[model samples]
Target chain A: MWQLFTQNWQDFLTGFWHTILSSIIALVFSFILGSGFAILETNPNKFWRGVAKVYVEIFRNIPLLVVTMFFYLVLPKVLPAMNGFTAGTIGLTLYTSAFIAETVRSGLQSVGTGQMEGCLANGLSYWQAMKNVILPQALKITIPPLGNQFINLIKNSSVLAFVAGMDLMYQGDVIASNTFQTIPTYIIVGIFYLILTLPLSYYMQYLEKKLA
Target chain B: MAIIDFKHVDKFYGGFHVLKDINFRVNGGEVVVIVGPSGSGKSTLIRTINGLERINDGSLIVDGKDMTDKSTNFNELRRDVGMVFQHFNLYANKTVLENIMLAPRIVLHRPEEENHKEAMRLLEEVNLVEKANSYPHQLSGGQQQRIAIARSLAMKPKVILFDEPTSALDPEMIQDVLDVMKLVAQEGITMVVVTHEMGFAREVGTRVVFLADGEILEDSDPKSFFDHPQTKRARQFLSKVISH
Candidate 1:
C-alpha cells in the first residue's frame, strides 16, 4: 500500500480531487433539486404534485448505474455528446435527489398543521407562509435524514468508476491492477471514504443535539 | 356595520354536521364571548371568520368582504383579522420578538423601524417585553400565550379571535392570560373569544353566545345569558359551568 501510494502519488491525488469536486457538485445540485421536488410533492396543486410523484418514483426505483448509463450512452445519441464525469454527476444528482425529496416531504409533513394555519391566519400568502414559517421548521426536522442522504451521495459517487469518471474508486482499481497490491490499495480507498463520511456523521449528530 | 357577519352558515365534516344554520353578527369594538361544552362548534365557528375553516353553505362577511365568495382573496382579508390559538401556536423556530415582527414585516410590508417599534409596544402590552429574544419553548404556558397575543396584535387587525386562549394554561397561569385579555377588551378592539372562563365572560363580554349541538341556543347580553339563561340547555350549561 505504501509503495503503491508513494509511486503513484500524483495519480491518487488527482483522483481524490476529482472525487471531491464531483461530490460537491452533486451534493449542491441534488439538495436544490430535491427540495424543489419536495415542495412540489407537498403542493396543493394536483398537477405539480403528480409531476413530483412521478419523478421521485421513477428515479428512486431505477438503479444509479442504469441511470448513469442512460445519460452516458442514450443522451449523446439523442442530444449533444457528454463526458463520463458530467454524465455520472447528473446521474448521481438525480438518483440521490429522489430519495432526498421523499425524506424532505416526510419532514414537511411532520411539521404541525397548526404552524401553517397560524401563519395563514396571520395574513401570510401560501408561498410566504411556506418559505418563512413552514420550510424552516421542516428543514430542521429533515437535517438528520438529509445528512444520511449526503453521506450516501458521497458513497454513491463511486458509481462514477464504472463509467470511467476517474474518481477515487477508479484510481484504486487502476493502482491495484498496475501494482498488484489489491488488498492494500482497497484498504487505502476505504480509509479515504471513512475520512469523508465520519466527519459528516459526527457533524450531523452534533447538529441534531444543538437543534434539540 | 358588523365587522364579522355569518348568515345561515353550515359546516360539515364528511357526514357530520359541525355548524348548523348559524347566524350571528359581531359589530365594531364589541367583545363577543362564545361558551359551550366540548364538540359544540365554538372553535369551528370562530375559525370561519378568518377563513381558517370554510363553511359548506352560507355567507361569511369579514371587514365588508364576503369570505364565501370565490373571488374574495382570503389572504388579503386575513390581514384585517388575527387569531390566537389554544396551543399558543407561536412559531417555535422564532424568538418572541420575531414572532411578533414576522407578519407585519412580511405580509403588511411595514417599514422596519415602525415594525420594530410596534412589535416592542405590543410586547410591552402583553408584559412579555423582557422575553423578547426567548424562544417559545423557553417560556411558561401563560407567557407563550401572551407572546401569541402580541404576534396577532402586530398585524393591527380590526378584529382578533381567541380560541380557548387560556384553557391550556395552569390554574395559576390562567389569570395572567385573562388579565392580558381584559386589557385587550378594554382597548375596544372587536374580539370573538371561545372559552369556558365564565368569570372572564361576565366581566368583559358585552354579549355571550351559547352553542350546543352545532346550534346557537342563546345569544344575549352576558348578564342575561348568565343570570337568566332562557333556554333549558343554556340553564343547564350555565349551572354546570358556574357550579364548578
Candidate 2:
C-alpha cells in the first residue's frame, strides 16, 4: 500500500478532489431543493401539496444507483449528453432531496402552531410570518437530522464510480485491477471517504451544540 | 359606532358547532369581557373577530370590512387588529425587542429609527426594558405575557383580543399581566377578552358576555350581570369561579 500510494499519488488526489466537488455540489443543490419542497408540502394549496408528495415518493422509494444510472444512460437521449460526474451529481441531488424534504417538513411541523398565529395576529402576511418567524425556529430543530442527510449524501457520492465518474472509488478500482493490489488500493479509498465524512459529522455536532 | 359586528354568525367544526347564531356588536372603546366554562367557545368567538376562525354562516364585519366577502383581505384587516394568546407566543428565535418590532416594520413598513424608538418605548411601557435583548425562553411566564401585550400594542391596532392571557400565568404572576391589561383598557383600545377574572371583568370591562354551549347566555353591564345574573346558567358560572 505504501509503494502504491507513492507511485499513484497524483491520480489518487485527482479522484479525491472530484469526489469532494460532487458531494459539495449535490449537498448545496439538494438543500435548496429539499427545503423548497418541504415548504411546498406544507402549502395550503392542494396542487402544490400533491406535487411535493409525488416528487418525494418517486425519488425516495427508488434506489440511488438506479436513479443515477437513469440520468447517465437515459437522460442523454433527450437532453445533451452529460459526463459521468454531471449525471451522478444531478441524480444524487434529486435523490437526497427527498429525504431532506421529509426531515425539514417534520421540523417545520414540530414548531408550535402559535408561532404562526402570533405573527398573523400581529399583522404579518402568511409568507412573511413563515420567512421571518417560523422557518428560523424550524431550522434549529432540523439541524441534527439534516446533518445525518449530509453525511449520507457524501457516502452516496461513491455511486459516481460505477458510472466511470473518476471519483475516489473509481480510481481505487483501476489501481487495484492494474497493480493486482486490491486490498491496499480499496483501503486507501476507504480512508479518503473518511476524510470527507468525519469532518462533516463533527461539524454537525458543533452546530447542534451551539444552536442549543 | 361599532368596531366589530357579528350578525347571525355560526361556526361549526365539522359536526360540532363552535359558535352558534352569535349576534353581537363591540362598539369603539368598549371592553367586552367574555367569560365562559371550558369548551364553551369563548376562544373560538374571539378568534372569529380577526378571521383566525372562519364563520360557516353570516356576515362578520370588523372595522367596516365584512369578513364574509371573498375579496376581504384578512392580512390587511389584521393590521388594525391584534391578539394575545394564553401561551404568550413570542418568536422564540428573536430577542424581546425584535418580537415587538417585527410586524410593525415588515407589515406596516415603519421607518427603522422610528420602529426602534417605538419598540423600546413599548418595552419600557411593559416594564421589560431590561429584557430587550433576551430570547422568549429566557423570560418568566408573566414577563413573556407582558411582552406579548407590548408586541400587540406596537402595531397601534384599533382592537385587541385577549384569549385567556392570565390563565396560563402562575397565580402570583397573574396580577402583573392583569395590571398591564388594565392599563391597556384605560387607553380605550376596543378589547374583547375571554377570561375568568370576574374582578377584572367588573373593574375593566364595559360589558360582560356570558356564554354556554356555544351560545350567548347573557350580555349586560358588569354590575347587573354580577349582581343579578338573569339566567340560571350565568348565576351557576359566577358562583363556581368567583369565590372571593
Candidate 3:
C-alpha cells in the first residue's frame, strides 16, 4: 500500500484538485440557493412558505444518489444537451440546498423575536430589519450547522462517480479498476476527502470563535 | 387636548377578553401610571396606544390619527411613541451608546454626530454616562433599564411607554431606574407606565389608573386614587402590594 501511494502520488494529487474544485462550486451555489429558499420559508405568506416547505422535503427526503442519477441519466434525455458533470453538479447543489435551507431557517428563528420587534419599533421596514439586523445575526447562528452541511456536501459529491463525472472518486475508481490497486486507490481518495473536510472544519471553527 | 384617546376599547385574545370597555384619555404632558394584578391588561392597554396590541372594537386615537384603522402606519406612530420593555430589550449585540442612538439615526434620519450627542446627553441624564461604551451584557439590570429609557428618549418622542420597567430589576437597582423615570416625568413627556412601584407612582404620576380583570376599576388623581380608593378591587390590590 505504501509503495503504491509513493508511485501514484501525482495522480492522487490531480484527483484531489478535481474534488476541491467541485466542492467549492457546489458550496457557493448551494449557499445561494439555500439562503433564497430559507427566505421563502420565513415569508409571512402561507402560500410561499408551503412552496418552500415542499421543496425542502422533496429534496432532503430523497436519496442524494438517486437525485444525482436521475439528473445525470434522465435529465439528458429530457434536455437533450445536459451532460453528466453538469447534471451531477446541479443535482449536488439542489440536494445540499434543502438541508442548508432548513439549517438557516432554524438559525433565523433562533435569534429571539424581540430583535425583530425592536428593529421594527425603531422604524425599520420589515425588509430593512431583516437585511441589516436579522440576517446578520441569523448568519452567525447558522455557521456551524452550515459548515457541517458543506463538509457533507463535499463527501456527497462522490455520487458523481456513478455517472462518470470525473470527480476525485470517479478518477480513483478508474485508476483502481485499471491497476487493480483497490485498497491503495481508495485510501488515496479517503485522504483527499480528509484534506478537503479538515480545512473546512477548521475554517468554520474559526468563524464560530470569531463571531462569539 | 388629549394626545391619546381610548374610547370604549375592547381587545380579545381569541375569545379570552384581555381588555373590556377601556375608556381613557392622556393629554400631552400628563404622566399616567397603570397599576394592576398580573394579567390585568395594563400592559395590553399601554401597548394598544403604540399599536403593539390592536383593539378589537372602538377607537384608539393618538396624535389625531385613528390607530384602530388597518391603514394607520404603526411604525410611524411608534417613532413618536417610544416604548421601554420590562426586560430592557437593549439590543444585546449593541453597546449602550448604540442602543440609545440607533433609533434617532435610523428612524429620525438625524445626523450621526447630532444623534450621538443627544444620546450622550440622555445617558448623562440617566447617570449612565460612564457606561455608554459597554455592551448590554456588561451592565447591571438597572443600568440596562436606564439605557433603555435613554434609547426611547433619544427619538425625542412626544410620548413614552414603560412596561413594568422595574419589575424585572433587582430591588436595589429599581431605585436608579425610577429616579430616571421621575426626571422624565418632570421633563413633561407624556408618559404611560405600567408598574407596581406605588411610591414612584404617587411621587411622579399626575394620574393613576387601577385595572383588574381587564377593566379600568379606577382612574383618578394620585392623591384621590391612593387616599380615597373607590373600587373594592383597587382597595384589595393596594392593600396586598402596598402593605408589603
* Candidate closest to the true structure, highest DockQ: 2
lDDT of 2 by residue, B70-150 (tens): 899999999999999999999999999999999989989999999999999988888999999999999999999999999
Instruction: Name the DockQ score for candidate 2.
Output: 0.87
lDDT of 3 by residue, A1-212 (tens): 77777777677666677667777888999998898899889987899999999999999999988898888777677677566677778889999999999999998888788777666666666776677677877988898889999999999988878877778888888889978989878987898799889999999999989877
The native-contact fractions of the candidates, in order shown, are: 0.80, 0.84, 0.37
Q: Best candidate per lDDT, number?
A: 2
Candidate 1, superposed: residue stretches over 4 Å from native = none
Off by over 4 Å in 2: none
Best-first order by TM-score:
2, 1, 3
* lDDT of model 1 at position B202: 96
State TM-scores per candidate: 0.96, 0.97, 0.91
Per-residue lDDT of candidate 1, residues B1-244 (tens digit) = 9888889999999999999999999999999999998999999999989988889998889999988788999999888899999998888889999999999898888999999999999888988788999999899999999888888888878899999998889999999899988888888889999999999999999999999989999999999998898899888887898897
* True lDDT of residue A60, candidate 2: 100
- For candidate 3, write residues B1-244 as lDDT tens digits: 8999999999999989999999999999999999999999988888888887788998889988899787888778888888888888777777889888877777788999888889888988999899989999899999999988888888888999999999998999999999999898888899999999999889899999999999998999999999999998899998999888
| Model 1 score (lDDT) | 0.91
Candidate 2 clashing pairs, residues 3+ apart or interchain:
none
Global lDDT of each model?
0.91, 0.94, 0.87
As a whole number from 0 to 100, the lDDT of residue B120 in candidate 1 is 90
